[model samples]
Structures are given as structure tokens and as C-alpha cells.
Target: MADLSTDIALDDERIVRALEEDIIFGRLAPGARLTEDSLLSRFPVTRHFVRQALVQLEQMGIVVRERNKGATVRSLDPEEVQQIYAVRELVQRQAALLIPLPAPQALVDQLLAIHKEHGEHIESGYLRGVHETNDRFHLTLFGACGNKYLVQTIELYMRYSLPVRANSMADRAALDISHSQHRLMIEMLQGRDNWVLAQLCVDHLQPSKRRYIDLVGH
Candidate 1:
């Protein structure tokens, strides 16, 4: 597996994004070694590209590398996961409240579409798809909050969250329940009740915190 080509050029940013998406989707497991040989074998990229990608993830606390240990996915205990989720809720909730709602309500409609798709994916028992779609739905909403600072902050937490979300998606019940929350959040957003929406966002986040602790507590 070490003879792969590096014909396709991948810049540092694209390389990082590719790895992040793959890792978040569990295509790369925690503690899985990301060797130069393995990456070369899998994709047509240079060591420079691969290192740049991994270095970005390391900075984000998503991956860690060592001389002897190589590069392995970063593992977070439950407390860390809880802290990440708490930050996500705080930043995103405030973002939703602070950002102006743009005209046409297109974003709200899009969120509904995502919820519908997630429900269908769950009903079909495509749990992985459900989690992915749900994540996109929430992130899109959070980004639309129109505050660059909040979006940037919450995105940092999501860097940690993506992997945990994927792991949690393994449980079909949990995936479905998580999808169910999307509607309530959208409803709150639609009502323009920033205050109530803030509280609801916190409430929704607590279950994730508790569940993560229960499943993989520190």
C-alpha cells in the first residue's frame, strides 16, 4: 500500500479539510496511525501535503503526532467532550441571538429540508447519513447567525465535536433523537424568540453532555 501516486495536487487547506471530513465520519478511527506510507498508499499526495494536513489538525486538537508514536487521532475523555459541547452551545446560542435574521427566511426553509432528510435517513436506518445531515443542518444555522466571531468560536468547538458526533451516530436511537431536536431549534429561530431559543439550545446540549459521559466518562 506504499506505492500510491501523488499526481493530484492538494493544498494545505484542502488536505486538512479532506482529512477532517474523513475522520469525522469515522473513516479514520481514534488512535489510528496516519503514517506517511499509508497516506501515500491511499491518496496521491506528497508528504508535505500530508504533514501540512496533520499539522493543522494537531493545532485544532483533532490529531496528535509523535516521533515514535506517529500520528494518531486525538482521544477525548467525557469531560473534554462535555466542555466542548458546552462551548458550542454558548457560542452558537449567542450567535443565533445576536445575528440578524436575513430576508426571505431561506435558511429556515433549508433547515426544515435537512430535518426532513434526516428523518427519512433515520427511518431507513441510515444512521450515519442521519448524523451527517443533522450536523450540516445545525452548522448551517449556526453560521447564518451572521456574527463572524461567534461562528469562528463555535467552529473551534465543532472541530472537537465532529468525531464524537460520529461515534454517537453509531447508536440509531441517539441519532434519531438528535435529529428530532433540529425542528425545535428551527421553530425557536423562526419565532424570533432569541431568549427562549438560547435556553432551549442549552437544554438540547445537556443531553449530549450526559450521554457522552455515560458512554465514555472520565
Candidate 2:
């Protein structure tokens, strides 16, 4: 029974991750309905597992469940986008400021490796790989702040901004800019200027926020 339970839990987690990747890579656009019947047909999981996955996604701010409307990919309005991004800027900048100057060689090396992978994904037009590696890069960079709570907050806001950031993920120019910025961030990590690093981190978020606002007509 314990083994069965573990298998079920792992199955549920797989469903959740698959759905999350769909949403992240734009296969599931904002406001696209996530009907039970469709999900049931798509994954080999039971209905209970599907429901559990939806609940988890809702909790993650990636999906919305309405009273009579069912679950759909989250769609953030311009104001909500602005507000969420404002919070993102604050927490991200704070996290950057907290990192020790002349960051540990280990952290810099890890970031450089991830940055290289990110650039390759961008060049290859692998949207999913691009998104995942880009996220890994930022999270790893902020993780060096040595404050778990701050990193957690930054991560939460990053998730919340997904809808706003989605469109840019597929834009070639945006991807190139992001790739270049990652290189700059790695270079800055080897220096002793925390403020410059902090500012760079903050600036990194602007293009997406501005692009989202403009596209949504605010």
C-alpha cells in the first residue's frame, strides 16, 4: 500500500509538471480552458489526479479556477501585471543587494554554465529549454543571496509574472537580449560592485514588463 501511494504521488506530480510546462511554453495560452475531459484524454492519470494537478497549479498562480467557469491558464490584466512586476522588482533587487560581493567562485562558475546553455537554447529556438534554463539562471543567481526567505519571495513573484513574461519568451530579439544580459550578470558577479549587480538585476526585468504592458494596451 505504501509503495502504491508513492507511485500515485509521483504520477500526480508528473501531471502537474507536464501541465506547467505547457503553460510556460505557450502551448497553453493565457485564458485557455483546461477542461477535465481534455486533460483526462491527454494524460493517463485518473480524474482525482487531474483535479489535484489543477489545484496545485492554482496554488502556484499559473491557473485560475472560477466558480462556474472551471480552470483556465491565468490571464493577468495590465494593472495586475504592473502590480505583480512592481513587487517582483522590489524583491529581486533586494535579493541582489544581499549577495556577498565578489561572489563565490563556485556560484559564478555555475551561472556561467547555465548562461551558456541558455544562449544555446535561444539560438536553437527551443522555447521550453530557453524558459527552463533562463529560470534556472536567475534562481541560481539569487540563491547566492543566502536568504532563503528572500529567494522564496523572489521565486513566487517570478511565477506570478509568468503570464506577463510568456509572450517575450518566444520573441527572438527578447531572447537574444536576455542571453546577453546573462553574460553581463556573470561578469558582474566577478567584480565587487553589489549595487551595479542589483541595478542590472532590476533592469533585466523591465523589457518584459514594458512589452507586456504595451501588448495589452495600457
Candidate 3:
């Protein structure tokens, strides 16, 4: 793995995001221990920042802290994965429905820009770029629901969904499909069709959920 500290600033949020990128890219594998000494060396940060990053990751359910063990990336169990996806499906579908029909041109253009960046990152195989852009794409799309609390809930569950989805950003075929879905979603917004868009949102999530469950059975 490349040294993250070289290119990026190491603040608490950036450090946590860096670790999450590492986890998603498979550089930090499931159940990998995130020791203070190890993290301190990886980034040009003090133990204070490292501890803060781990705590933030813990709250996001990407990492867990146990007595005397410090912290390790959380492993997703199949049952829990199913339940999370169930709720995620519901929330995402509802969010889709709530988006104002005839999405403003400004919002559509913003989504288009983000999706374009996602394509560029996927083509270059920049895993972290792809990850961050993907998050922005989804967050921007769902945030259009115009309910801050709903957006917050969706974002929270999206973070919790990360454990199972960690390595998915690396799959080229998966990225292709995902990007295509993003295009379809953009079209849905253009057409101002809520029901079809809602269904598409639900369908879009199934591939990753199914792929994860198949790889890691309950």
C-alpha cells in the first residue's frame, strides 16, 4: 500500500477516512488490528489523533474496540448484513420516492459531475478516489430528499454497510455495473419518475449485498 501521509493532510476526519479507504481497498483486511503504534507510524500524527480516528471509526461501525485489545476492523456477519440491507433498502427506496420530481437542473448537473469523477477514478483504478466519489455521488443523490434527518439516517446506515462492502470498489465489473446504475438513476431524475427510481434504488443495492453474502455465509 502507498503511504497515505505523503499526499493527504492527517486530521482526525481525514485519518478516519484514510483508514476507511484502506479497509475498503483490502489493504487493511477484515479483523485487522489497528494498533496505536501501527497507526502512529503510518500517519504523521500523534496518538491523540490516532485514538480519535479509531473512536470515530468505531462509531461508524467500521471498527470495534475490545477490552485490552485496542481496535480491529469489524467483520460483517451474514445475518447482520441481511438485516442492515433490509433497512437500507427501505430507507433508500423511500428516499428515492421523496426526491422532488423534475429534479432541478442544478442538482442533476451536480450528480452528473460526481458520476463523471467516479468513472474517471474507476478507469484509473484509484481505489480511494473511487470510494470517495462514490460516497459523494450517493450522498448527493439521497440528500435531494430534502429531509436532513432522513439523509442523516441513510448516511449512517451507509457507513454501517461498509464492512461487507469494503472490497467491492476494486471489482471492475462491479464498478461498471454500479456506474451504469448511476447513469440510470440520473435518467430517472431527469424523467421525474419516482416509482421506477425507487425500484431501481432497491435493485441497485442487491448486487453488493448478494455478492457479500455469497462470499461470507452466515
Candidate 4:
């Protein structure tokens, strides 16, 4: 497991992102405690920055802070998982419908580039890289919907889903399934099949949702 000592001289955003990466990559397991003293020691930052980072992480649904406990990586129960994925499915379906098909050559090229990088990361077994690149691919694709609020909501929901994804992110089979869907999404965009693309978008969210719920006894 990678430790804080390795993260030297990082700013607040970097700290938050690094912590989030650790959680998603399983370096910081769900329910892992996050203390100000521990975080301050890891990065050259003040308590304010550490607190701010924790607060941001909480808002992102990656961490939970209690009255007695400072902060811990967040975990979702079966019901919460189902509710979130249901909303995600709806938002993603709408986003897919909004994407203009044949998907502007520029958008297609951009998605292709992201997809290629995602594949490379998966091939190298770089879990953090895979997570990051996969996020980029989806953000870029969803952003094409041209609805700022809609895109923002989707991004928020995605963050909320990250911990759930962590339950299966390490599995090679899961990664393959995810990347395959990504490729199909790109192909659907190219073909201008909005309904199929929308259905694929909804279906794509199922595996992770099911995997997480199964782990928690859904």
C-alpha cells in the first residue's frame, strides 16, 4: 500500500485528488480513517487545506465525516447503491439522447484518443491510470450533451458511484467489460444510433451496480 510519505509538496487540489485516487485504487480501503494530523504529515500543507480537502471529498461522496470521528472513506448500503445507479441510468440515458450523432468529428476523435489511453492503462494494469482515463472518456462524452447543468449532475453522480465501483475496479474481467462498453459507445456515436447508444449507456452502469450490491448483500 502506498503511503502519505510518498506524496511530497502537493497543493490542496493535488491532495484531494491524490486521496481520491488512493481510495479508488484500493490503497485506502472503504471505512479507512482520515485524520488531519495524518494528512498534514503526508503533504506539506496546513490544517486548513487538509480540512478543506476533506470537506470537498465529503461533498463528492467519497468520504464521510462524523461528529466524533474526523473522516472515513464512505461506503454505501444496498439501497443507496440502487437509488444512485437508477438516477445515473436516467441521466446517462438523457445525455446519450442529447449527443448529436455521427457525433461531430472532433468529439469522435477526442473520444477515440481517450479510449486508446484507457486501453493502454488497462493493458499495463495501471489501476489509477485506468480510473483517471475512464473518467476523462465519460466526462468528454457526457459534456458533448451541451447541457451544462445536466453534465454537472452526471459528474456529481459519477463521483458518488466511485466507491461502489472500487468494489469491482480491481477485477480484470470488470475492466474488460467496462472498456468494451466504452468502445461500443464510441461506435454507437459514430453510427448515429441514439436509441441504441442510450440503452448501452444505461446497461453499462449495471455491472458495477450489481457487483457492489452483491458485495453488500443486496
Q: TM-scores of all models?
A: 0.76, 0.94, 0.89, 0.90
- Model 1 alpha-carbon drift over 4 Å, by segment: 1-22, 25-27, 99-104, 124-132
C-alpha local distance difference test of each model: 0.73, 0.89, 0.88, 0.89
Error of 4 at 91 (Å): 0.4
Query: What digit string (tens of lDDT, one per residue) describes model 3 on residues 1-218?
Result: 86766433448878988888788888888789999998888888778888888888999889999999889988887899999999899999999999998899999999999999999999999988888898899999999999888889889998899977665777899999999999999999988689999999899888889888988884
Q: Which one wins by lDDT: 3 or 4?
A: 4
Output the lDDT of residue 11, model 4. 60
Q: Which should have the higher TM-score, number 1 or number 2?
A: 2
Decreasing TM-score order of the candidates: 2, 4, 3, 1
In TM-score terms, candidate 3 sits at: 0.89
Q: What tens-digit string does per-residue lDDT give for candidate 1 at 176-203?
A: 6777777887877767567777777667
* Model 1 worst lDDT run, 10 consecutive residues: 1-10
